[model samples]
Target: MRQQMLNNGQQRIGKGLQLSFVLLISGALIVSSCAKIEPVVINEPAYLRVFNNLRFKVTVDNQDQTHSTLVMLINPEYDSNGIPAGAEIIGDFLVTRNSYAPPYPSHIGNSLDVYNPEYPGKERVNAGPILNGFDLSSWAQVPSGQHRVAFYSRPRSEVPFFNLEMRYRTEPIVDTVLDLRAGEVYTLHVLQKDFNTKENGILLRQENFHKLALADSLVYVNFYNMSAKGFFEAPHTVKPNSGNHLLGGLNLEYDWFQEGIREEMNVFYVAYDERFLRQHYDGTIKPLASFMTHLKRDTENPATAPYWSLPLFFNAQDSIRSFLFQEFFFSRPGFDATPESFMIPNDGPEGPGAGGYARLLCYGNGREEPPAPRRQNYVAVPNLIVTTHSGEHNPRSFATVNSIEIVNNSVYLTTVQRVYEPPVY
Candidate 1:
């Protein structure tokens, strides 16, 4: 797919910090300084499909070079026509002879120019500009259905822009009837598996956190794009019997530099243990009905972090819960405060810190189940958090960390939340 807006000044704060992070791990940060993007066009355009074997006649679209386009599938989300929605096309074959030169200044362009000591031009591969290879694949587990694929060039400026054409498969859906009853709780274990990275590794911001539905209570789910990096990469290793460890990453430091770093990060998901939730509340999860979000520190770069949600509202009447979860009178228009806070506490003295769950305001579409007091389902909307912190190496450098909070509300489903099935994947 074509690139969305990539020029955000908000990200500049982190570029320096990222460079510093690289420097600390490698003793020095490297830069190709002199890389050129050359486009290549194959005899046939690269073709991708839903669930089938494909041999794309890849082409490098550039000037004066027969650059090989490396294609890797990404974000495998299929459209109504069963084609990939988006993928990353990086240009690693280009090189710049000079880092500090006129015309080619040091700017973070779509074509990333990283320096590698072992390359022919001492220029490691970076995405974009010209000949960077493109990753074209289906999103993890392309839904078994018919969907359209969106094909387009990205970043706006390639030596010459290319067009995308898609191929798809059509099928039928069969329904099976199973005698199932409502009210009785069903135990479901959702395992989110994906690949990690050598740079900023990926972590499961959420695991099979607990979700309980009493008979016919409603449940709403929301999903959001947290980061552009590591969203679709996977096939990482996990420790024995560790369910929470779906999110993982590679050590860019060790991978880029020659470090003895051989171990990978294994993050475990905190399951919605009936015993734990029961221990925290009563044995029943419906009683503690609520929405929640918390922050988790990134082990690789403590400055970077992830936020999580805890059940916030529960088996209460909608009218009352709605009012309770409503935005605090003092909340900013954009909700730029503590995410997922509430104005009042469940049961406390009325006033300052005495009243509601500070900042626990619920907005957007909700599910319809049994009445409030009998409500069984709890949904979390989607939202995002962007944090800017001081860099570890260059005090002048700063890092901007963005996290996606797919509460049952707005971030993703926030705008689409409604009274029906929980909005989860």
Candidate 2:
């Protein structure tokens, strides 16, 4: 009986040992599987978009090279004091190069002539010229930090102007420093404040370029106010006139003061009305004749509507401490009398319009040509100062709104031009 009892105890101990071994092996397999699993990684890239809003027309006598500006993005090696040792050319873009005649206006021209350091005259491979008005579809990948930008103008050889050493001469324009963050997109607007002085300035604006999943009814618009003069010491406010009251009633989505760099206004709900009209030459008001008629919102095809609006209004202070709209007013006669004639139409769907996000820029500088009609009803619409006759780079004119198709979530630019005509009694 004792021997049997001892054998039973041994069997029970063997079963217990087997269960322990199984548990240990199971735990080891679980840890090994966990170690083999890898974490998923995602890469985000930095992007840059540049716009040559400068009015520097490079024409030789009668020749029109209005779009000969060359833009470059440089990444300089910093010294111990955090200063750049030498700028390394990273991006080269040629803007508004081709002849933009009537019918098909082309803003994409040639690439910048990048001479190789090792072999002069040999062009280096670079991301080509960005089309004027439109965003750089191809994002320029750059390091997330501060960077320097330079602008150059290619000499027009037609006038026998010869720079034996260099094909292009660098403009006196000041280099711009940008603080870029990883996974963010930036837009740099190179503007020439005064064509007479050839003064240059830059406006830097940042954007979130991440692809968004938005509802079908929704779209995004961004406004950039680049109309303010940078070189002039005097305030950029418009000269006091009664016309300023037109804009006083309308609330702007976003307005950038001369001191402000850039701002992203809140997203607006799509809305449009045909209540706007232009005054005819014969004391008649024509409905939907003005550029503001294009502000209508289309739901079935949002691309047919204006997504972004940039209304440039200058304010001048009166002795009475009141503000008035400087240049744009109502009661102007003749179709050509108002600066509205110079505005490029927003290409609608199936039309030449770029479609997605429509950018409308309304500009007027209080200057009107001789034979100016007397101001009546406290309404006056001044014509934009025509700095360049080339028609491509009108200093007073607004940038062309490229057609953008809203297949997915996208951003656009827009502006407003108000016209006041007496209501028919």
Candidate 3:
């Protein structure tokens, strides 16, 4: 009786042990079936901006013609199944900006305008809209490292770049690689090095767009000499024939610098013409800013190499406690209404533009020769004297400037302006 009882108890214990093992396995399976997971993808970023300054000469119907219009394409994306997503248009209808001042006002119906009750949409408009400004809300992000870039000439028309036919992409003016560093900003310039040879290429330069310290009254600036090799030469100054089929025999009478107008010559800064040369010869006048031809491009880091500075306001208060302001850079030539510096390059004063200046008593006046730029004309004309202030009511509202980029005598004043202003200060 005792042996039979022990055997039965042992059998029961074994059954219980088997049941516990099965339950433990089932519990683990249940937990494994309910497991959760989350996956993510992160892209390292670098910044790049494009400028299509390509004014290259192309042979059209056996005639050479120069154009500034360009369409740029960066690394296009592709899907996982080896299907093309689309070619991204990094830059489209990009032409070198002629004059960046007195920005094209945004009328009432502009899409970018906001609601202002006091200043009705119809009553007042945004006075300053940038010329070919980029969206500053977000910098163009790309994975750091090498990027293939290409520039093609497209028709200057209402059509978008992608809608254009395959003919436009047949001939790429500039196709190159732009190796960028992570967390760095850059500007890719498509340029024509020489009009004679039409040597087209790309130049990538690291850019610094941070505003300078706004504490003191100052106007900050820097200079870049992106002039072509044939600048001031005949090949660049003279335009090729567009409709000279009638002048088949007399080819000498082709369209060339007609009406005393020249292109891509010396760009004078302050006086625009002779003051630049005279200032160097005699120490009578020093320009607020001056850049000699063949000026070297800077490769220094932005933080270390700050911009050149100029006074924002002139304090001419003697005893009456009156504060004066400068209206025109070249208010009256030779007079100190402008900065104490007046001399500009003898050939141009470095044309900022053709506004705000008149022929004010200098070598350029009373000359019988064509109004074309002279080699050493004593007094020069000014493009315009730069103003320190561009605001009406706010004294601290200094003229907003980001970069003064010059390419083929076309100046681009790029501003990283804020598009939206919150209601509260």
Candidate 4:
């Protein structure tokens, strides 16, 4: 009985924090007759999603990378009665692994016994906060204008976000006000920009999941290079990947002598084919599909980084003898621009092994699930998709991965799910 009362108290406190956070940020938006100060009003709603790509003290490829889970506090000290108190906890112990959290109605709460007998294996049995890579998290809504939010490093322990000890010890990593637009979906990415200075910044990008008219076999994919300023130019031997460990460079001496690497990155892939084929770096086997794009120059470099999405043509249709996984690579220019032979010398792991080629994200769309011990359905690759916004990585019929976020040596994914039962607005 006492535990239940404690739970109810926490709920009440959370509600009060949400209410006050908005009011304080909005500041009444009072309207004046002579000097009109437009009041901020949220008619519909603006959606938001966040990613924690902020590399911290963890050493990766000889450099520090982000390995900390965070807790987000809104109005750390505010209440409805104008009293300063414990802050509201929105995101707790949020990590890089992708989990699902959409805006939901308050009454429809998440439950452990909320299972359908018709679908036995579908629901997680003892799922707590995170299940099936999806959590009962919701997008905390706010007026689409400007709002203050702070992210702090929290311990993976019994201490809750509301505890005074935790709050006092945790320091803010990201503290700023965000300017948002109404009726627009936004994704906020906190990235570690520099290693020496230990500075981090957020990259806010508009997310669009609007249905695109495409065939069932096609999936949309766009690549955004969010690596540090000198990602390509840096001498990296090994970097952190999604797996227990996923990064190992082939060659990283480009920076040793100021060698100008190739501008375009070679992308090589083979779809789910029944031909029983394999790709080799010795130029024997050819990739089923291949494309090339220019790499984003380090912010420190004189070259300008392109800020547009590339719609790569990918077919994820499953077929007979179809392998449940796909492998792809990004390498510097080769003899003829082909992935196998026309590649940088010793780019892959095998023959002579180097770093230029060990950078690729491997996720497949197969009919049957692959072997167990998978990373949210993605296999180990050179550079694994460290985090994802959605778990629908391997869409059965093949769907577009609309938003693909890439960091220095990590990757995050969000796919356009095919509507089985469309939602009625």
Q: Which candidate leads in TM-score? A: 4
- Model 3 clash tally? 17
TM-score of 2: 0.35
User: What is the TM-score of candidate 1?
Assistant: 0.21
Shift in Å, residue 120, candidate 1:
39
Best by lDDT: 4
Q: Which ten residues in a row have the lowest lDDT in candidate 4?
A: 116-125
How close is every model to the real structure, measured as TM-score? 0.21, 0.35, 0.49, 0.55
Q: Which digits, one per residue and each the tens of the lDDT, describe model 2 over residues 1-425?
A: 43444445456675786655555566566566667645333234355554444333123552433343443436545447543334555333344311111111122232343321110012222221233222333334555677666555443232211222233332324566767776665555455544344465665655432333322222233222333232212222321111121122222211111112111111222121111112223334321223322222222211122334322222232111111122221111222424323222244222321121222121232222211122221111222111222323222222222222110111122211111122232
- The CA-based lDDT of model 3 is what? 0.40
- For model 1, how does the per-residue alpha-carbon lDDT over 1-425 read when each residue is reduced to its tens digit? 01111223234447766654444434322223334667443232222111100111123433222111212232234468654444333222222111111111123333353421111122222211211111111111122222222212222122322232231112111111112122111111111112133221112222111222212222222223222123212111211111011101312211100111111211111112223332465434432222333322122221223333322223353211211122111221233233223222233222222211222112222222212322221222211111112233211111111222211011211111111222232
Model 3 residue 293 distance off true place after TM-score fit, in angstroms: 10
Candidate 3 Cα misplacement greater than 4 A, ranges: 1-42, 56-67, 76-85, 101-139, 209-216, 235-237, 240-306, 316-396, 399-402, 416-425
* TM accuracy, model 3: 0.49
Clashes of each: 94, 18, 17, 12
Model 3 scores worst on lDDT over the 10 consecutive residues at 116-125
In model 2, state the lDDT of residue 388.
23
**Per-residue lDDT of model 4, residues 111-222, tens digit only:** 4432211101122122112212222222333447767778666555445555635333345777887777765555666666764455766666665434234443434455
Candidate 1 achieves a global lDDT of 0.22
Give the alpha carbon lDDT tens digit for every residue of 213-258 in model 3. 4333444444453545654344322533221111112223221111
